[model samples]
Target: MATPNTAATPTFMVFATLRDDTDFAEFAALREDEQKQLEVLRSQGRIGAHYVSPARRATFVEVVAADEAEVAETLATLPFARFFDAEVYPTTPPDPAEIAHRARA
Candidate 1:
């Protein structure tokens, strides 16, 4: 499987919560389409990981893009996107040296 080269571009963590007024039936109806689009993004190396918390009605996705606007543009393609209140956060891997120092402290 192809993966995004995180060294070449920025990575973002998108946290999207389903609006309280969202219709569960409508969300379910659009699930298949949403999955298809997600698969496409994954194949294109635009997405790294996708996780959901059904109990909390929230989703967390790792996105690879140049900026937050690009991340939003990528997510906007999802069928259920209109129902989401999304926040995009820039992310970086933890520094290994810091981790080692902390471990020894």
Candidate 2:
């Protein structure tokens, strides 16, 4: 059965294996694309919030997405995210953006 795209709510796991280490340029190319997607995600009314768990700069991640597939194909599958293996698991009241923002500071 095809999972319904909740559009408004669901967890999207974004993960990827390095297709090639020498592909450094690959990630650089999509830097702007990533920010654009974040804008799309917010404007589309998909995610209420989201966050990541970085394991040693690069590894497994658990992302909260409005749709599982959306996170993988759109966010995590991006060049910047292609380095880690990710899983999208349901999080009640998805992680707060404030926490991530504060962490950056």
Candidate 3:
């Protein structure tokens, strides 16, 4: 029998800097690859990922994990990990509902 995936208390944010020469079409393809990877991570308790684009020289990627180890493994597995300037940070994110709740408080 397999153990069910567990959720981590605090997630993580991973940042990736795209190569200077990266173009839109290329990153778009890369994004598809990333989505595939996320499916694997999701099975292992990954919360989600966030991606950002800058006018030039880098892209930022964020991955929310159940714990540090989960984040580390996910980062290592990313096809683009070695291609970009990458860093992982520990984080606690507010749920969207919580954010809405806070806005009203």
* Candidates' C-alpha lDDT: 0.80, 0.47, 0.59
Per-residue lDDT of candidate 3, residues 26-88 (tens digit): 667787787787677655544354556766555555555556676666677866665577677
Candidate 1 lDDT over residue span 1-105, tens digit each: 233444545678999999999999998999999999999887776777899999999999988788888888888888988999999999885256533533443
Top candidate on lDDT is 1
Tens-place lDDT per residue, model 2, 3-95, is 322423445433344444536676668769866766655554443344444443343333434456655555543446654455555545434
Give candidate 3 misplaced runs (Cα > 4 Å): 1-8, 20-32, 93-105
What TM-score would every model get versus the actual structure? 0.81, 0.46, 0.56
lDDT of 1 at 95: 55
Error of 3 at 71 (Å): 1.5
Could you give the candidate ranking by TM-score, starting with the highest?
A: 1, 3, 2
Q: What is the lDDT of residue 43 in candidate 2?
A: 50
Clashes of each: 0, 2, 2
> RMSD of each candidate?
6.8, 7.3, 6.1
